[model samples]
Target: MRKQTFFLLSLGFLSFTSCIQEEAPNAECDIVTCRVINLENYSIFYSRHDAVKEVASTDSVVTFPVRNGADVSAIALELDITPGATVTPASGSVQDFSQDGVLYKVVSEDRHWSRTYRVRFVPMMVLPTEYKFEYYELDPNSQKYYNWYGMNEEETRIDFWATGNSGFRLSRSSALPDEYPTVPVEDGVSGSAVKLETRSTGAFGNMVNMRIAAGNLFIGTFDTQNALKDAMKATCFGLPFSQKPLRFSGDYKFVPGKDFQDRSGTVISGRVDQPDLYAVFYRNTDDEGNDVMLHGDDVLTNPNIVALARLESPLTTTEWQHFDIEFDYRGTVDAGRLRNFGYNLAVVFTSSIEGASFCGAVGSTLWVDEVKVTCE
Candidate 1:
């Protein structure tokens, strides 16, 4: 089976870390980063900084958001890949991206592993205001898990949504898409809704002291490799935003699993699972001019946060419920910075409030749909 890698290119800046060089050929085939050389010459981008992309370790697609009227034909990309690997349609080579998605292949130096990447370019960012959970599909390569995305008014697929499903794959390769923590269900307020369930990670998870995988969906990216070293940091949160958000509204149904457990999988006598839904707006850069992102640990408490809107209490009901929360401003927003994409917005949904700590009941479930973010 071929290894999989995912890449997301946006109008914001990101600096991807490179892997250390190994002495000998290894079985790793990955695309660490992607960029266009001296992108200033390309007037098609909203910003020259938009040309570079930070790659992640799961999924099989690469997407770039370009300004309207940008010519993708003969567009060239320079990829920074694993030391001993080689990519086809070679790096720094021009490829026609004017039509259907193009496929790029990468073979490891050891020739033991490979990955095929699907690349596509979409026109300008359409600030996502509503999410109905109507667009989703199975992972292209494995067909083992589902990937959810939002569609814009132009009918273009938006890649802003990210999930922990990829991280869950690390423990359950044989698990079916439905058996995975996050899935789509037919019984929705409308057509289809997302269902997040806390699931047992079985032996593999227990071995690593991570017994349960929480179902999560958020506006950001996931790094599987980083999760192994530091789970909290693995869930990079927020995306560049150009507006001041006012409120977050959504519909949902929830059921807390019977037995609450800790990271060691030991059930706590009286503890109960709780669902979490919140939206955060914050500065995307630090005082030192370095790009910044909140993780599972500090997303809510980060000093950079400008405003936050979260449910005050847990909601548990079999029937659908509605909630609308207003953003509580903690700081001021600079109009100049807002126009320059200096801030970010993150909206997160999880079946278990403490899922990031691997503490949740395996059967806790939350169904959600009709999400809307109101802005000024």
Candidate 2:
């Protein structure tokens, strides 16, 4: 499952006593941790730990993955919130999560701030084979950017795709949704497809040495907290996958921007922008048994990578083009580890191949649709 779990850190006995002597509540409203209780009753989950999810600071939606037929209509949830904060619908209360989702509101201790979060239980019975880019809407929190979501074969909504648009929002907060780096296009090869473009990050970006933002989408999470300071780490890549991938195919239309630029936003003569599309399969643990995830810097060249599939040549075309690449295995697969969720898979697409280095040509665009992964 792509859903990340958490480890509840133990608080010191001294801290517990200090909480009882609190005189005032701080002005912070956040869900620090969340876990589903009574896991024994839910036989669908692999383990008690698998049902827990650590809420990200920038995330508004919390999701847990369970078997497709699992009943979550009356499950109990426990939430650890900020000091002196209060949560609506109450913690440790039974709620229905079989449909859309349950919305919970958290108010700061001083009532100066509030945040609404939607918690969901996602069914994970089958892997998604085809991506049609069908469902998308404006970012619910900001309403200033676009978000793309996919559906599984069972017609259940899936949130396996993540984008750098959230990071772009920091640079171009006043820009309209359509003007952002990534957006949804109504006139696609099929229904609605995703359009990625390399965009200029105004004066603030240049001041921070981040002159451009590239449009990118991948099968992983984006940590908005470290976006500006450490972009390579911000793009956490890959998701747990049990299947062995054979081929990756997709359709795309690309038009490169002229006069490619460097990290300092300086134009390079005779240079042209190039788009990137690739997938990686790798082990998800280090030698010491600690969880490991690839980032933008190591996704392509990581030593733990078992197989990779990448476009061999730069694709530059105005008309839609189809591409099918075969996975090239570099290491043997461990069947037992793969079955135990010990491996991860990453599929990535970017409007500018060098975008990770803050180098790319603004106005370069790439339209993609009908992507699929053929597995063994």
Candidate 3:
């Protein structure tokens, strides 16, 4: 009887030790605990122990370990709830945690998806930031419009003004004295002697007669020297009509002595019956000792003088008629000829005068307007 009792006690002790060895420390816990972490921004989330673990010993529970700085906003778990296990807080909420090592639950929501209980703690706010510049409108009356410059020992001030038409004007004061000319404007004419009033001078003023003659205004003359040299500089704008081979229409008449050459015996005439011929139309260098003359085989000789155009009028001598003359730069001329250097146009007259007449007598009289240069 003593031996059997000892045997039974030993057997019971062995069975108890075996049962203890078979059960895991985790399996012995009534509730499992876990923590969620955000790796991107170092945010943390705490889980509830009682809410995320199984109550029965047969139930399986998992606990996840998280660090202090981890992102738990999108935390997830792979485990499904065990048959005998119950999870708390059906769905997890991302929030700040007062402590670490929290428990979580893996609970099914529907037939397709399941959610895990989690808490997110973010220390810093995630937002977009940008840099920008401040802009201000320019003030016309501001003192910034003037610039001051210091020379040797003195200072000079320069004023700048932006005009209403988007143009700029500058003024400066000098220590030295200088002479300035008076400017005036009359009937569309503008010069140093005249202040320019009309921007559309081609419509009137010096070009007024040109417009009346041509039925259109040509950009007559600018202050540019080249424009002054080229009588038909305004033709650079464009042609007016559909007529082929652009033409200049005008009327011209000659008087023997008054309009023609005088006693200098240069074979050149003095003036024409129409003063407009010499005054308004042609660019004459005859008075300046340069007379236009024809040279060998398609070459003209002259200095400081360019014949714009010439045309024979079909109008009767009694009536003021119109004529058209076309001039072009591309034409064959003699080799090594100065006249051929810049031949933009040519003008021929029915009456020819000797080269000698240019020095003594005045040239023929011709009135010209309505000049047109067309592109071929």
List TM-scores for all candidates, in order.
0.84, 0.82, 0.20
Give lDDT tens digits, candidate 3, residues 111-216.
2333344332332121111101011123243322121111211222211111111111111111111110111112111111111111111222123221101111
Model 1 RMSD vs true structure:
12.0
TM-score of 3: 0.20
lDDT of each: 0.86, 0.85, 0.26
lDDT of 2 by residue, 307-342 (tens): 999987757887889999999999999998777667
Ten residues in a row with the worst lDDT in model 1? 4-13
Error of 3 at 17 (Å): 99
Q: Name the candidate, 1 or 2, with the larger TM-score value.
A: 1
Error of 3 at 16 (Å): 99
Clashes of 3: 36
Tens-digit lDDT track for model 1 on 1-376? 1222223332122334444456677788888787876344867665555677777777567777676778788777888888889999899888888896578899999998999888777665665878888889997867888888887777877778888888889899889889999999998888999999999998888888889999999998888888767999999999888899999998999999999999877899899899999999999888886778999999999999999999878678999999999999999999988876788999999999999999999999999999989999
Estimate the overall C-alpha local distance difference test score of candidate 1.
0.86
Off by over 4 Å in 2: 1-25, 35-52, 67-78, 88-104
Measured with C-alpha atoms, the lDDT of residue 205 in candidate 2 is 86
Which model, 2 or 3, shows the larger lDDT? 2
Stretches of candidate 1 exceeding 4 Å from the true structure: 1-24, 40-49, 64-66, 69-76, 88-105, 110-124
Compared with the true structure, model 1 gives a TM-score of: 0.84
